[model samples]
Target: MLKRKLLTYALISGLSFSMGSSFVHADVTKLRLAVETTPGDPLNIMLASFRDTLQSSAEEEVELEFFEGGALGSESDLIQLLRAEQVQVLPIGSDIVELDSNFAIFDMPFMFADKQTARDALDGELGELLADSLREKSGLEVLAFGELGFRIISNSRRPINTPEDLSGLKLRTPGSATRILAFEMLGAAPTPMSLGEVYIALRQGVLDGQENPLSVLEEFSLYEVQDYVSLTNHVYTPITLTMSANSYAELSPDMQEHVISAAQEGAYQTRQLSDTSDAELVEAFTSAGVAVNQPDLASFQTASVPIREAIAERLDAVFWEQAQNILEPR
Candidate 1:
């Protein structure tokens, strides 16, 4: 977190949550986990596994309730819930940067050379650094870094074979300034949109396409609307499964350890899903009638240099250099 224009968690304290909310339980120490990903998405799958793992290991009676498919609202809504102590945990995607700009470093185009190196960065000190920043800035407990994997572009218009191919395409991007800037440098007309609005926007021709991991495409039914899948791998995003520190601090030490261990289990499941699906997802797209192409990744990687460097420098030159050091060669 840059420490400039910071939004404090205290802002959400005055709000009241409905007692009848499905995610809350009275008899047991219940953990409510919120996610925007559709039910079958790998992140959700990991969350479900986490639920089982935590409940089984917990010393006392515990329950984990999940709100998926944006049922509890957007990622921003979940953050507010965390602040209000209405939810115990949240598996948030890259949009987390909206709360802390330095989180944008995770979305910096081509931040990790490959999935393993990225996992190493996150599972190691780099992950702890971001966790410390999150706790310091927002009063959230970073359970573990969840994976979003490599982002690929999909379109209904033309096949994207090169950076030039993206020109004039109405590409839908997350609300990250760094991402928008990277796409612009690559020549695409990037439109910042929420995930909930993306499918309809693509289906109705309002959006030429969108970018996400392959699992998102299948889980969200993007394949039905988008005709092409380009392995652009423009960004590798690691999401966070975070808890409200206030709620966490109230737990018994034993329960707290169980929760922490379960989160690690969830992280493992998340990474394992990506390792197995990276290639299978492409085959899935092809089977679903989406034309898949391996574009000249070098072209997109090259286009990202100036924009990524500028964004990284503006964020933190020292931290960025440190991130580079932690990176394992692809």
Candidate 2:
């Protein structure tokens, strides 16, 4: 009787151990990431690099699942999922950060001088400061910051060489206060819409124009709908790789290090892909018979000064000043 009892006890213990091991393995093996861009877009190309690198380097089996091109819903929806720990990671536009208010700094028009300047700002001390601020304020971990390239204007109407040209033109913009104010300051009627709707809206003449990076413009085939592409470079946009604090806390220390490292590497690669795609997109637009023009950027800059001042006023002078300090030569 004693022998039989021992055997049964051992069997139960063994089964419990096996189930625990399986649960641990399952936790370590799965990751779900969301991105708003299509699979072939530069953003996805960069994410693929991260996915590959993480799979190769992790000690445990790792699988990355991507929800792309609004298949997972809009950025706002994804953020909610991240907060709920349903989604593990999101590569989202800076505009999405406005939901947290602290991320509003990135929306400051002409805040970044160029791509290189923006890269330096985000990858340097300022980037760390911003990332830390975001983690503290929003309960999300910013693994890495990347470039979406500078945003330019694409319109079905005449080329916008000066602020006057934008007058009365209905322009589609992201649902950020800064974006709306920027276009409003420039005298254009800014319509806030989801990116997925922009292409259709433009096609149906619901919007006179929209703004985005060259890669985005090309990805959505906006070139086919819009006749004029103006290199306004009005806003320097950054793409952030964000993870839920709850999800991140659940990772083992080793896994956490691996995840952050992989994201940083992916961000660097994505920036390169974005740069290359920007150049290629210009050619693609030209080939597609879109009239591309490099208008004097000075006019755009001059027009934005008042808009910046207004934003600074609303955000309080100190916050705006600190942001400027971060961008200034150091």
Best by lDDT: 1
Top candidate on TM-score is: 1
Please give the TM-score that candidate 2 achieves against the real structure: 0.87
Clashes of each: 0, 0
Question: In model 2, which regions exceed 4 Å deviation?
Answer: 1-29, 59-61, 316-318
Tens digits of per-residue lDDT for model 1 on 1-330?
Answer: 333113323323322334333332444677777777776686687677788899888735687677877676667767777777777788878777776666878666777778887787888888877877778778888888878799999999878988999998999988888778878887889999878788899999999998999888877788899999999887888868888777888776877898889999998888888888888988888988999998987877787778777788656566666666666333
lDDT of 1 at 250: 73
Candidate 1 has a TM-score of 0.88
Q: What C-alpha lDDT values do all the predictions have?
A: 0.79, 0.76
Candidate 2 — worst ten consecutive residues by lDDT sum?
15-24
**Candidates' TM-scores?**
0.88, 0.87
Off by over 4 Å in 1: 1-28, 328-330
